[model samples]
Target: MARQDTPTNEMSLRWTVCGDRDVTVRGAEPGDVSALRRFIDGLSRESRYFRFLSGGQVGDAVVSRVLGRHDGRDIALVVTDGEEVVANAVYVVNDADEAEFAVVVADAWQGRGLGRRLIQHLQQLARAAGLRGMRGDVLSENRRMLAIVRELGFSTRRAPGDAYVQEVSLRLAAVTREAWLAHDWFQG
Candidate 1:
């Protein structure tokens, strides 16, 4: 298979973090499955419950889908501390006009800006892939994720569902090279 060419930035890049630990965020590779599993397994029971809406583990088929390549426009990125996968963000191209997004961060790394960084990178990837907008559903009680989406300027609306089940749809602003460059969280 032909490799996708990542875009080159013409200017210097900067990232802001609230923690001391060093983190690296990059495109996910097939070989990183075990690391990804380890990180996912480390999330708190509540976090896992919130993310998957169930107690069951993330299955192999889902992992394969997350790690697979697409003939259309899509990208998946993983954040790591050396050999461990601590977070992942994915952008699934829906059409010429929009894309779908999802992100997961380990419990141990929560509240440290890794999710924000991952989303920022995902946004850059979306723009580079020529997508116009992005959207996703987040549980309403997931405040950390809500704050991240709000900080990134996504317009959110209550999702239609069983009234008792809480969730919201986050729709990001039209993705453009200039807007991505202007984002405070963008590192490259």
Candidate 2:
């Protein structure tokens, strides 16, 4: 597969998926802030809570940090259906080699592999940015994300928080350029 550098125009991406169902992944831009907000707003309450660890509310400062960080230290990708944003994934490098990741898919678009695609895309970005691995803290009740993590071969361990409350941390194996390129999920 060919990897193009991040696109300068958020809307100038060439759709790689077929059947007129456009799917292009790229870095977030200034113009995409509102669309990203709208997409986040469209997420189901359950999904929001699962991703953000809170009931459907995220502060504007957090949203802006995710959307406006064009530098490689932070990365965000938006998957659009025509003009509507349907899925999003973001990652921020925490240390020299580790990054934390989160993903959200609109309620209507769940179970079509959009979440998988977004994770794959984010993994590519993470590897490109020299991150050794990606980590995520997923709620125990979120089975969809758990399945995705397993499918991607992440080694999971229960994060030490309130043991009485349920949640687990998943750490994906080190992703190299070769490993990412060789991943079966990316092979057409």
lDDT of 1 by residue, 1-188 (tens): 11122332331122334534555556677887888777767878777766666556878767766764755577777776668877777777775556677888887777777777777777766776667777877777777787778888787667776442334334444556877778847554
Q: Report lDDT (Cα) of residue 7, candidate 1.
A: 36
**Model 2 TM-score, all chains together:** 0.75
- Which pairs clash (backbone N, Cα, C closer than 3 Å) in model 1? none
TM-score of each: 0.75, 0.75
RMSD of 2: 6.7
* Residue 157 lDDT, candidate 1, scale 0-100: 68
Model 1 residue 62 CA deviation in Å:
1.3
lDDT against the true structure, each candidate = 0.67, 0.70
Q: In model 1, which regions exceed 4 Å deviation? A: 1-19, 70-72, 164-188
Clashes of each: 0, 0
Candidate 2 achieves a global lDDT of 0.70
Which candidate achieves the best TM-score against the true structure? 2
